[model samples]
Target: MPEHDDAKADAKATGAVTPQGSGRASKRPARSAPAFGAFVRKEPVRAPVRENTQANTPVGASTAQADGLRVETAQSWPADAVEVGAVIEAYGLKGALKIAPHAQGGKALLAARRWWLLKGREQPERHSAVRASAKVHGDSIVGQLAGLTDRDTALLLRGARVYVSRADFPAPEADEYYWVDLIGLDVANEAGVELGKVADLIDNGAQSVLRIEYPETGKDGKPTTGERLIPFVGVFVKTVDLAAKRIVVDWEADY
Candidate 1:
């Protein structure tokens, strides 16, 4: 794995190769990237102005109808909008089931009114849809799906995945972002030099880090790429704007 400093040096030494996202690069005159280490100001990523969806709308609003339940085809949901949590088997006879969220921010699960369940298998298939309401149960969450009303019914939900809409989530505080919000954004240094797209976020217990993928060309138009991991600390990351789908960092093109 390359470090941020190594990436900067590679970019500067190479010159004006294809910008990072182009998935191609060629030897060319090196351009001096912007000085991003100086400006520490934060900026909003500006969400597109749109009329707010109706407040009366239910959670998983697109799936709902006049009958108070909605069915969502797997194809209809945006990949970024779904969250995965595990159902830890039946809690009791009342159709309630134990849930373990995939993240510490799991409390967001209880805050939403409805969830989509898909059972896990050797190869999980999306089937047997259910609508449910959730509430916090000690350190975990417990919820009742409309069709599950007994231990036997709940047992069927064991190891099921819980999918909730991003819209159902509460607004994050300033300087904070949900991991999903940051996953696909373009990252750049203050100097406006492109780094790479955010490939994944890793939680190393103490803090989160972003994995960035950098593309390189090899004579031919085909590109090869490498990855670098950067800590998501205030010192490294200056601003994150999900609306703009970009992350501005305090790093240097040659860092």
Candidate 2:
């Protein structure tokens, strides 16, 4: 995973932002994300699987029709849905798509059976049941949607952003955590001095780094801004309690 260089202005500080497949759980120093996608689920919140009914047609079936397509809006999206990648182009003579996965890579996409696609920011979003998906060379993904069978149809989907439900994401291993889960957790040193909340994380070849944002106080006792880039290794990150939304580290705020 590449580092998120830009600070997220709208980073969810507190909420049920469980980890999806894009990021791996942080445990020890030098702990790398698995070759496949890594995601974690906070039990009891299963991904919603709405069956097709007369009152409500399946999302894909309805979106196929021009009239149904107009009804799509942000409100129709699943609460757990997270953008994972985008369709860059059509692949092969057969109906297949080339995907440019977000920083987390295609692990979550590979594990998902269905995918949501959006053409543009304000455009309606639609779901496509996946028939097959595979990781390919160049850190990309090649996938086949159930109803698509020709290159022409696949080309039409180019530039569409892909999203997967967090509920559908597979669980992480012991001591592992999803990146989403750590984003808003509070950070404190061993002495109990408040540092800041996690702003984001980035992969620095060997390990993930936590970008923390705290407040800097001036000589007059006015609060300013402070940022810290701490390595997420076990050496620095002593303990992580997701339920408590707190992380105890070995470093001090001034350092």
Q: Write the per-residue lDDT of candidate 2 for residues 87-172, one digit (tens) a residue.
A: 77667887677777664445566667777787645545464455454544355667777656667556656667777887765565
Per-model C-alpha lDDT, please? 0.55, 0.60
Which regions of candidate 1 fall more than 4 Å away from where they truly are?
1-72, 75-80, 120-133, 137-139, 217-222, 253-255
lDDT of 1 by residue, 13-85 (tens): 1111112111113565433432211101112122233343431122233333322334455686546455546
The alpha-carbon deviation from the true structure for residue 151 of candidate 2, after best TM-score superposition, in angstroms, is: 1.5
lDDT of 1: 0.55
By summed lDDT, which 10 consecutive residues of candidate 1 come out lowest? 35-44
Prediction 2 TM-score vs. true: 0.68
For residue 93, what is the lDDT in candidate 1?
72
